[model samples]
Target: MLSFARAEGAMGAFSASGTLAVMLDRNAAVILVNEPAERLFGRDLWVTGRHLACADKNATDALRRAFHVLLRNPTPPAMLNPVPLPRLGGRPLLAYPTRLPRITTKAHPVR
Candidate 1:
């Protein structure tokens, strides 16, 4: 899995193939490069801290709802159902959610 760490932001770990992945943080932002994903959806100009839905109203609303699902589940979700991007003047892409591992607060002992 792609292990990325941002001390003040979030962590998204995906496999080498990039098929199965997980995103954890207050922001539900991501970067994608599929032809359809790029053509239908907008790209993050800054390359960071930008979600595809920010510019698209429909994606924004759907993403908001997906966040709600995470909010309701304190234990974190086991899986994220796919969310289709708005197509009719909407973000033209499909987003699928995959559950991330539970974060544990264990400390490593120094020898």
Candidate 2:
């Protein structure tokens, strides 16, 4: 599992390398995104707090299913092929989901 710091480092490398990349938390929320990704998605604003499912309304169901499968499986899949990104007429992009180290807290009062 990738730690938060490691994930951030990875994102930096990816950004420097001009690779389109995004890091999502276990809950499938956008945690980090690179420049190429921003251009590809056509947005310059920070998307860290947004959920991936809501990022692309056209691919909501597909994104939800993909995230669900990744979350449920112990191992990451080779790739989530042909993920439709919210772009000009919805372009398909290959997606890879990496598991991040689960953050545990003591406050377990409510769900």
Candidate 3:
């Protein structure tokens, strides 16, 4: 049962081709990403070691707020507004962020 559960969980993460799972550090830096996430963020793999803030100020701000909220409750998925990614040839993407426990700060009540 455990083995089946583990496999199912792993498969779930890769179930969607264009979907992404982004891991952010405390300083708002990209820590880890799956292959699909790399394509989704587009060219961001080149800037992986840098702060997400350097990519796009507007997106950075939005990400910060969403990160904070996620750290607090770690529930209720947040939808990141669609934005034009110029580095990716001005392609539009809607990033839906889910707050995972390890990537978040201390847990708090959701308001």
Off by over 4 Å in 2: 41-49, 53-58, 89-111
TM-score of each: 0.50, 0.61, 0.50
Model 3 lDDT tens row, 1-111: 554354345435754654556555555566555666566544542454464432566765675676666555446455444433334455445555554434224557999
Q: How many residue pairs clash in each candidate?
A: 0, 0, 0
Report lDDT per candidate: 0.48, 0.63, 0.52
- lDDT of candidate 3 at residue 47, scale 0 to 100: 53
lDDT ranking, high to low: 2, 3, 1
Weakest ten-residue segment in model 2 by summed lDDT: 40-49
lDDT for model 3 comes to 0.52
TM-score of 1: 0.50
Candidate with the larger lDDT of 2 and 3: 2
Give candidate 2's whole-model lDDT.
0.63
Model 2, 1-111: lDDT tens per residue?
Answer: 345667777778888987778777767778777777777554412343386543556566676678777777777674565555554454456555544454433445766
Candidate 3 residue pairs in backbone clash? none
TM-score of 2: 0.61
lDDT of model 2 at residue 89? 50
Candidate 1 Cα errors over 4 Å, as ranges: 1-15, 20-24, 27-50, 87-91, 103-105
